[model samples]
Target: MKPRRKSVPVRVGNVVIGGAAEIVVQSMTKADTRDVKATLNEIARLKDANCRIVRVAVPTREAAVAMVEIKKASPLPIIADIHYDAPLALMALEAGVDGLRLNPGNIKDPEKVKEITRRAKEREVPIRIGVNAGSLPGRPKEGAGVRPPTEEVVAAMVNAALGHIHILESLDFNLIKVSMKASDPPTMIAANRAIADQISYPLHLGVTEAGPPRTGAVKSAVGIGVLLEEGIGDTIRVSLAGDSVDEVEVAYGIVNALAEKLTGPNLIACPMCGRLEIDMLPMVAEVEKALKKIKRPINVSVMGCVVNGPGEGQHADIGIAGGKKEDEQKLAS
Candidate 1:
């Protein structure tokens, strides 16, 4: 079994983050935060999709005000994503948010961040410091207005996070989460690694602007997946620029992709060779589709014929071998 990295445990409402807790899965709401009914409806959809935590943008006073009702109606804890306006962050906190997120570097004004941290510490709300390649102070300076290399992106994020942490630390606040998101896979991967080396605060892993579902899901899985494999991240977001429910589904997949070490089921299949007689493609797809409904911790195998079938895949907790149907029934059973 792989070891999880050492990280501080940060709680978001009742959910425990970092430090051996199952990686928390989160997705942002697509509905405008000002639209209480619509945002509530969308978060219901995300919750059904298994989103562990939900973040909504608090870009306006109306949204910050709406957060009171939204938080009232929400079944899960709400994390308000605030940028540029520390007042909005302050208002949302008063509106009864469970957690807060802000890019302190972008907040620009020092006094506001200090006050935000003071209020947050009072409420016991954990803060997530989001640092993006597009918003980093030195992103342009580091790469001459082009995309920065991995180390620079990491440096800027850690610097930004540490900057915020310093203010919060001075305010005697300790609960925090941090993320450094990039659209590129390698930069995202490298940035997490670099930050992980320097900070023990829980890390939220994500690749922002990762396109449409199929393409974005692949990129998110690879980047977040690789980081999680290294035991580097605590919470994860699949930032698909689409339905937030899909983001939740992809987030769960990324976290549990390697979870077969203890929980859930894993499927293994063999590609058919010359021994292929039956059209097994549809059969494999059918079984895989059905297996999604199985929450049990078991291993399932679907293999081709005698050549590539049974020998290697027999270790599955359960299995099926494809061949002449009548002869193979007992073997698969």
Candidate 2:
């Protein structure tokens, strides 16, 4: 493997991001953060699924107040997502959360921002300066509107990020991470690249408000996948609007794909062209269903005709292929 680029590792609890550590996977809890029991249950599920860090919305006072119990029960470290109100930031920190997410586009007050930074320093908690092109402010009326050019969008996000950065730096609080997100693939990719060039902070990567399972995965995988390959993101989140567990699953899949070793099951099947052999479809289907329930990273393959199937599936740890007489043969290579 090639060497990692110039980057400092940021510690989220015991897990490390960047600097020779295995990429860390994080997911946000959708349960109302105020509902501690529900939130804890969700967090526990994510933890069992190997989630390294968990983020939760601190939208209201009840949610912010519940951070203490959530933090106590969480198997992984907690990040409080404080949007507009800076007071929630203090509440989360006081509750002993491991980190804070302060969105510059949403946090409008300077004094409240300063106090949040100061208190974060006192509490020794890390802050994530999150930005999304969707939430970018002050775009001119007649221009591209929500879809500003990647460079323009990056500048806006970086400026707001730096503003919050300066406050934290002034108070000598250095545990900072930044993210610049957009719904469109190209915009999301370019904004993150531009921001990485400007700041040395670890980056959190994602495409916000990505739609359903199929399209959302493709968008996130393309945008974020490109960045990770270029050695960009430090921490990543797959912001699927649906099941939070799916988000965790997708994030890990991307990481696994990035790794040199193919850990999980690898599906290799022929398109069932003219050379197809006896009952290849059912054979391949059986292999897939068998491996679907696997939790550990294990590799398997399925193919159609014996001619191409065996050779192609040879790269896999365990594989199955169609054979004569309505039967199939399995291979290990």
Instruction: Judging by lDDT against the true structure, name the best candidate.
Output: 1
Error of 1 at 46 (Å): 2.6
- lDDT of the structure predicted as candidate 1: 0.81
Give the true-structure RMSD of model 2. Answer: 2.6
- Expressed as tens digits, the lDDT of each residue in 1-333 for candidate 2 is 233444667787777776667667899998987788999999988887678899999999999888988888888999999887788888888899998898888886778878888887777777888887767677422365544556666677778778878877887778888888888788788878777777778888998888887788888898888888888888889988788888877887787777786545556666787766666677667766775556666766666567866776576667666666554555664
Compute the lDDT of residue 212 as modeled in candidate 2.
86
Q: Which stretches of candidate 2 lie over 4 Å from their true place?
A: 1-3, 140-146, 263-296, 326-331
Q: Estimate each model's TM-score.
A: 0.86, 0.90
The per-prediction CA RMSD against the true structure, in angstroms, equals: 3.1, 2.6
